[model samples]
Target: MTGPPNSPTLLREMSERIRALGELPQTSEARAEVEAALGSKWWGLRVLAIAVIGAWRDKAWLVERALRAENGMAGGRFGHARTQSWRDLEAQTAAKAAVPMLDPADAGWLLDRWFSDEPLAFAFYEYVGLRLDPTAVERRVAEEFARRRSQQRRLPLFRLLRLRRGVADRDARLRRLAQGGDETALLARDLLSMEARFRDRQAQTPGGAKRAKVSAGAARRAAAAEALAESRRRAGRKGRR
Candidate 1:
C-alpha cells in the first residue's frame, strides 16, 4: 500500500537530515525529529525513516528508536500480529529479524512458524539463512528432515501415485493424509510427486525453487466431494440448523 522510499517530501527531508548526520545520529532531539517525520500521513515516509535508521545497525539508539516508532504505527501493531494468519509476511519479517540481534536458535523457531510446514518456504528460508549462519541454518533444515521421517510413519499412497512418488515427497499434508489408508496415501503421493516434479523443473532455472504448484482440477474435484458429503450431513443438521 505504501509508495517508494523517497516518495514523500518529508521523507526526503528526513533523508537529508540523516545524510547530514553521516553516521548514526546520537541526539535524542534528532531521533525525535526522525520519528516525527515518519509519523506523516503518507505511510511511505514511515518506511523510509525506519529503513534509514535500520541501515545503521551500529547505531543501537537509532535502531531501537526506529523500532519504537514502528511499534507506534497502526500497521506495525495490527499488521505484525496478523503475521500469524499470513505466512508470507510472517516468514519475511521473521527472516529479516533473525538476521539482526535475534539468536540462531530463535531464528529456527521463527522460521518454523513462518514456513508453517510448507516445504518450499522452508527450503527458501534454509538457503537464505545459510548466508547468515551456515551451521545454524543447516541445523534448522534438519528439522524438516525429521518431519519427513515422522510423516513416513503414517499411510501409503496408491490411487494417484505411490507414497514414494510425486508431490507426496515434499508436501507436509501428504504425511497427514498417510495416516488414513491406501486411497489417502495414493492421492497424497500423487499430489506430492506432481509438486516435486514442478519444483524440480523450476529449480533448474534462475530463481531456484520458489513457486508452489496447486492443482485446479484436483481441488475442484475434492471440493465437489466435500460439498456432496456436507449435503448428505445436512439431513442430520436440519433441527440443529
Candidate 2:
C-alpha cells in the first residue's frame, strides 16, 4: 500500500530499518536484507543501505565483507537512464567510512587516483587522503605542483587551502593562493575579496569602504573568470566534465 508522499510511517519505518541493520546479530538474514536493499528500485534506499553497510562494519563478521562490498559498489556505474547519477556522494561516503582503516599505501593510492581519475568526486578523495595523513598528501602536492598543468593543479591547490584549518595558517594560505596565476588562485582572490566585503558590510559605514574595494575586486574577478573560461574553450571543454 502506497503511503501519502513520504508520510510519517515511511520515515519512521525507514529509520527503524536502518537502526536495525546497525544493531542486528550479524546473521545471514541481516546480510541478505542489506544486499536486497542494494538492489532496490529506489535509489535513496540503495544509498541508505550502502550507508548502513558502512555504519555496522565494525562488527567482527562484517569487517571484511563491508570493505569488499563498498569497494565493489564504488566501482559501479549503476543508475537508471534519463536521470543524473551522483557518483561522488556514495564514493565520498565510502571514502569517509574507510578513512579510519587506511594504511599509508592505501592513502597514497587514493591520492594518485584523485589526481588521475577522469570523473573526480569533488576533489574530496584528495580531502580524504589528506585527512588520513596531511603530511604525505602535502608532500605529494608540493612535489607535483609545478609539473601539473593549470587545470590539473587547481584542485590540489584548493585542497591545500582547505587543509590549513588554523586561522593564522588559513589566512596566510589564502593570501599565498590568491597571488598565484591559476584558476585556483582566481578563486582564492575572489574568496578574500568576498570576505573583505562582508567585514565592511558589518561596519555599515559601508558606503565608500565597500563600494570602491568591491568594484575593483569584482572587475578583476570577472576578468579572471572570463580568462579561465576562454582557456577552457581553447582546450575544447564547454564546462560539463
Candidate 3:
C-alpha cells in the first residue's frame, strides 16, 4: 500500500516513529513496524526504515537487503534522479549495515572493485576501511597504496585513502608529494596542519598535556616497531637473493 501523501504531516509522522523506535529496545513488533515502513511510497520513509532495521538487527541478510535497496535507489547512472540528501542517506545506511558483515577477503575484493571503478561511491570504501583491522587488511592496503603511487597525477580519492590509512606522516613519498601544488597536496597539508593544531592545543591543557605525552611515547614505539618490521622484511629479501 502507498504511504501518506508527501507533506509536512507525513514527514513529521515518519520522524516521530523513528524517534520513538530509537528510544525503545528492538522487538518483534518493532521489526514488523519497520518492515511496514519499508513498504511506504515515500522514499524518505523507506530509507529511514532500512537504516533502522540495519542498525537494530545483527542479521547479515538484513544488511545485504539494505545495501541492495540503497544501490538500486541511489547508485549508478540513474542515481542523478534522486536528491543529494537522499543519496547521502542511502550511502550512510548501507555502509553502517555492511561493515560488520565484511571479512578481510571481502574488504580486499571491494578495494579491488573500487580501484577498477574509480567513480564509485566513497562510502563503500570508507566504511570498509573503518571496520577493517589494519593488520588484517595490510596486504590489500599496501597493494592499493602502491598502485596509487605509480600514477602520475594523484587523485583526491587517493589522498583520502592515504589519510584513512594513517600513513600521511609516515610515508616519505606521500610527504614529498605534499610539497607539490595539487589537490592531493592541499588536502595533505590541511590534514597535517590540523594535526599540528590539535597537538598545540593539547599541550596547553594539564590533563591533555599528560595525554599528549603518552600519545607521543606511543607513537615513538609504533614507529620503532614499524622500522623493525621493515628491517626484517629487507633482510628476508636479501637472504632470498
Candidate 4:
C-alpha cells in the first residue's frame, strides 16, 4: 500500500491524536487508532505511533506490530540501508521498552532473535537481558559470550561481558580486572566509587542534595581523567624501563 501523505497537516493531525491518546485510558479502540497510525507511510509517523502505543500499553502484539512496521521499510541502496538500520534500531528499542509487560516466553522469543544476527537484534538482546530471567537465558548468554570473545574484534564481547558481570554482581571478577589495570574495568570502578560517595553525601545533606550531586559528578569526571592519565603515565614508564 502507498504510504500516508508526508504533509504538515498529516503531521499535525497525528500529533494531536497521540496527545489525545495520552489523555484517554488504554483501551482496544485507542489501541486500534495507534495501529492505524503505524500503517502510515511516513517513517517518522510510524516511529511516533510506536512510541505512543509502546508508552501507553506494553502489549506483545503492539511490540510485534512495531517490529513488522519497521521491517516493511524499503531499503533502496547503501545509504538507504543505513537509514533503514537506524529506523529498525528505533523500532527495536521501542519494542524492548515494552519488555516489562511481556511474558517470559515472549521475552525468550525476542532473545532468540538475537542469534539470527539481524540488524538491531543485538541491541534488543541487551535490553531484553535487563528484564528477563537470567537463569532462563544463561546457556544462550554463555554461548554468545564465548562466540564474541573468540573474535579478534573484542569490543562487542567486552560489552556483553560487562552486562553479564553487572547483572550477576560479579564484583570479584570486576575487582580482579580492575587490579590488572583494564581501562574499562577501572572506569567502572571509578564510577561505582563515585556513586557510593554521592549516596553518602546525599544521605548527609538531604536539603542541598542537588548541588551536592552535581559537585559529586564533576568530581567523579575529574578523578576519572586523572586516573586514566596516571595509567597512561605508568604504561609509558614501564615501556621505557
Candidate 5:
C-alpha cells in the first residue's frame, strides 16, 4: 500500500519532535530535530526503535533499491507485476550492508519493501543492519551456522564420505535443498561435488597418490542403492505430478 510519505501520525510526531528541539538554547532546527526525536514521547522512542531494530526508512535504502532493481521497478513508474525470487532478493539485500556508504533514499525504498510475508527480508534486514558491525559478528554468524549444522548432524559415516573430498558449511545449504527435494539444490550439489572431486584429483596427481578406489563389489552395491533411491525419487515426483 503506497501512500503519501507524510501521514497524520507522522506529522504530529514531527511537531512534537520540533517542539522538543526548540526547548534547547543552542540547538539548530536540524540538531533539535534529531534531539527532540531522540527525547520526545513515543516519537523519540520510535526513532530509537528504528535505529536499534533496523529502520527501513533510516538505514535500508540500498536493500530497497536492490529489490526494486530485481523487480524491474527501477523507474518507479509502476510496471506489470513481475514474479520475484524472494529468497534470492533477500540474500542479495543481506549482502548489501557488507558494502559501504549506500544511499539514504534507499531507506525509503526499504520501508516500502518491508512487507510482513517476507520473513527473510525482515530477518536479513535486522541481521545485517544490527548484527553486522559488532567486533565479532562474523564469528557469531559462523557459530550459529555451526550450531544448526550440528543439531541436524547426520552420521559420522556421511560426514566422512562427504568430506573425504572436502565439504564445508556451504554443503549444509545443499543438504537442506536436497531434503526439501528441490531440483535446483540437487543439481547444485551434484555440480559442486563434481568440481570438488576434480580439484582433489588434480591435487592428488602431483603426489602420485591414487584416488580412493571403490572395490568392484562395493561399486556395484553403491550403484544398486543409488538406483533404488532414484526409483523412489522418480516415483515421488510422478505421484506429485
Candidate 6:
C-alpha cells in the first residue's frame, strides 16, 4: 500500500481530493492505503496511516474507519486488551479528529467490541503525518465507560468522562468498581484518581485546561515528527540500497 509523503497514487489522490472538495473525498486508492496501514502489524506503517487520516480530505466514512482502527480491539471487560486505554498518550492525542467523529451508537457498539474476539495491535502513526484540532466525542466515550466502570480500556474512556462527571451517581459507580478488588478495578481507581487531579488542576486555573490541551497536542506533534523523521531516514536508506 502507498500514500502520503511519497507515492504516485497519493498524488493522484491529491488531485482527486481537491476536485471533490465540496463532497466526500473520492480517492479510493488512497483510502485503501490508509485502511491497509491501519491494519498493518508494523507500528511505523500504522503511524503513517495516522498522519494520513489526520489530514485526509475524506471526512465521512474514512474518518469513521480510522476511528475503528485506532480504537484498538477490545480485550473484553475483564480481559480488555484495553486497546484505547493502552494507546500511547501522544498518539491518542495525535488522533485529534477521532473522538468527535464517533457515531452516537458507538458506545453500545464499542461495548460489543470489548466483548468480541477482535485481534488488537498498536500500530498507526505514520501515513499522512499530522493531526488537526481535536473534537471531543466525550459523550460517546463517557457512555462506554459509565455503562460499566470496570469495562476494559477504562483509561481513554474515563479521560473523556469530564462532561459526564456532573452525573450524581459517578462516585457510587466508582465505589462499586473499587469493591471488586480485582486488577481491572484497581486500574480504574488509578485512572479515576488521575482524572480527578487533572480536573481539579483545570478548575484551579482559568486557562489551565487549554494549556494542558495544547501541551498534549504539542507532545503528539513532537512524537509524530520524530517518528516520521526516523521513518524518512530509513526510507532514504532503503531507496539508496
TM-scores for the candidates: 0.38, 0.51, 0.48, 0.48, 0.23, 0.29
Per-residue lDDT of model 4, residues 9-66, tens digit only: 7687776776678667788888888778767766666667767776776676656664
lDDT of 3 by residue, 70-176 (tens): 55554563456555456556556756666666665565556555455333345666654455554544454445545564232223234333434444333443455
Decide which is better by lDDT, 2 or 4. Answer: 4
lDDT of 5 by residue, 5-88 (tens): 455666565655454543444335455445444444443343332232122222344444344444443443435443233333
Which run of 10 residues does model 3 get worst, by summed lDDT?
Answer: 150-159
Off by over 4 Å in 6: 1-26, 32-42, 57-96, 113-169, 172-241
Weakest ten-residue segment in model 4 by summed lDDT = 149-158
Steric collisions counted per model: 12, 0, 0, 2, 2, 15
Tens digit of lDDT per residue, candidate 2, span 1-241? 2356567677557656855786566677887887886676555666676667767654332333333433444556444332234334555555455445556666665666555633434333544534556567657766666687666664555445444244345556668757768755675675556545544554466475656454543433444454445456755754555
Q: Give the clashing pairs for model 4.
A: 3-41, 4-41
Query: What is the per-residue lDDT of model 6 for residues 95-143, given as tens digits with 9 covering 90 to 100?
Result: 4545445443444443343333443122222211112112323343445
Tell me which residue pairs clash in candidate 3: none
Question: How high is the lDDT of residue 191 in model 4?
Answer: 43
For candidate 1, report its TM-score. 0.38
lDDT of each: 0.43, 0.55, 0.56, 0.56, 0.39, 0.44
The CA lDDT at 227 in model 2 is 45
Candidate 4 or 2, higher TM-score: 2
lDDT: worst 10-residue window of model 1: 155-164
lDDT of 3: 0.56
